[model samples]
Target: MCRLFAITSELPCSPMTAITALDVMKEGHDGSGVGLFMTDLAGPWEEFKGAPILSGIFTNKGLKQLDHYMMELGFTTKYKLSIKLPKAPPPGVPKRDVYLIRAYDYPESWEGLSQEEVNHRLMMIRLQLRQMGLDTGDMVVFSFWPDVIMIKEIGDPMTVAEYLGLDRKELRARVIMAQGRQNTNYAINLYACHPFFIQGIATMTNGENTAFVPIREFLESRGFPGYIGYQSDSEVFTHILHYMYYKLGFGIEMYKHLITPLQDRDLECHPNGSFLRHIKHTCRRLTIDGPNCVIGVLPDKTMFMVQDRKKLRPGVVGGKPGMWAFSSEICGLDAAIPDRDKSKDFQPMYLDTAVVGSDRKEVKIWRQTEPLPLQL
Candidate 1:
């Protein structure tokens, strides 16, 4: 039922803008299957082009509130914005849950469905559901972010259990609830972020902007499930804006009035559902494990970087700076390198800092470097 009762009140202040994902691709991004980075986010930013948007990715339980929030703010998307989301997991634990879904498709098949088609499908789902009185997106938060549950452990079993005072035969008979005293506090962070698949072609190669579904093809061996799939808020917003202008005949002032509620809701609840910082810090807390240099903050999440610096078989490493970037620290992307003197044994000059740039869509290699200010 949560999926069937969400609604939004967003009123578009503009016409339905037409566009092609390829049009926003950065130069050299001509389908060079690589990565899109923070810079690549520029591409999406450019495409959005000053359109105020109310975007969010969270799990169930908060869908109803969040949906209302987005609508009041003058935006739209494919979310069951009226229903309460579900708990995705318990606290202090990581669960990479899955979802299944079926989005739209283009005429061509790039391996399977193109990103644009996926985005379109997501957009379409929200609108279709709006008519049906349900929302697939807002309720989707449950797929990822589960509700948090608190648990407690009992200790000193003998003190709390009658079995301790019983005879051997009696004690053996059902040990009636030993260890009933509270010994520890436990809480589960069961929560999931809403899954919004903004389907677009594999455009940016600078390697960034990978939301949920882009990297994982799970939960959809058959069809992407609503709880596990995604929808593009951008497309959803376009539809909403178009509806407000032409369908409902809302003016700029009316739209602005609508947006105020969104802003207020965001101010109260934005940034409630992201785990990026936690993931990043977990990785930063990693150490080198033998031949493998693994860094990760999570007890379970570990990643391997370049092998030992002493190794000299293939590509660049820390000490061997033929063309590699190095900071004084390991994995330092902006490692300061001295002038192009072949006599220096490729050893970078002892400087406090450096910079690097790259044009490669796959591997971003910094082409140049500048020193950071030396503090006395």
Candidate 2:
């Protein structure tokens, strides 16, 4: 167990939005996870080494050096690590199958490729899928067009033809054209810092779908128009880390270590690259997310939150004190439900001002909305 330490300053106000000068849809489709996993990103790992019970892929032989990290400002005294140790986690077979199609080695700017070449490229992608193990359930996250994904045999060629009740041959052609190779070839790569703790990703999903969603919202905000862009999986993840993960992400590494005990140990069922963070970090580090810092997490400087689908207020989070944190363990939205049937109606605490900064200055903000604009 660890003793509580004071936050250096009053917990900073929660950051509501984030959009940087560099817009990268450039990170891997997979982004960071929700909440802090380990105990600490600073100070000593010794404080959390033997805090009761835990297990990990690695025994901490103390051979490698640790990097700085960040997480939300919550405390976990006696916690169980669902997965830990060893940078990567056991992997699992895809729900169906996947494939790495031909590499896209376009010039920094595809100024050279003719439109005809682009068509050939999309057609090649479709043919590649047919040859690869990819099927209806198989997945494909393109390094260039990451957002567009090919989920095996999406849409019904037969369904389309039947729905139109037209010539089977002609209907198939139109249906195929509508669904198109490009659409099936890529997906809109959305990332959220605090992914939801959901059992499975369904047809409708919020930030839990990916780690870069929070900042994505900010990028699409009125403050910035057309600020974010994406083409490949790597650029998408890199842009996410560049905008959001610079400092606080390493803190997530600490969270990663703490949860080492709870992970599944079977080597076959689960393999390396399956662990969420390892997948995200590897995506970022390998440029599977983006080419350079151009595609990366926003540093600690940027603040944002991911609103839980059930809890309208929850969103992507990062920073030190009152740092960005999300939890599936405790359900705030569940608790927020009022006991109207009781003797009295209950309301959550709302402070007009959470704190007074230095010089006794008054800082006002809203809980349901963002602060007013600042004057130049």
Where does candidate 1 stray beyond 4 Å? 1-39, 42-46, 49-57, 77-354, 358-376
List the candidates' TM-scores in order: 0.20, 0.21
Instruction: For model 1, state the Cα shift of residue 98 in Å.
Output: 10
lDDT of 1 by residue, 224-330 (tens): 33322223211122222233334445422222122111223332342421222332233222111121111100001110012222222111212222232221122
lDDT of 2 by residue, 1-376 (tens): 0000011112221111010000011121221111111111112222332221111111122101000100111212332222112332223211111122111223334457675454344334333432231333132322112111111122222222222232311111000001101121244221111111110100111212233444344334524221244322222333333323332343222211211111233312432324533544433322111101110011122211112222322111111222222111112112211221222212212111122122222222223222212221
For candidate 1, what's the RMSD? 25.1
By summed lDDT, the worst window of 10 consecutive residues in model 1 runs over 1-10
lDDT score, candidate 1: 0.21
- Please report, in order, the local distance difference test score of every candidate based on alpha carbons: 0.21, 0.21
Residue 372 in model 1: lDDT: 12
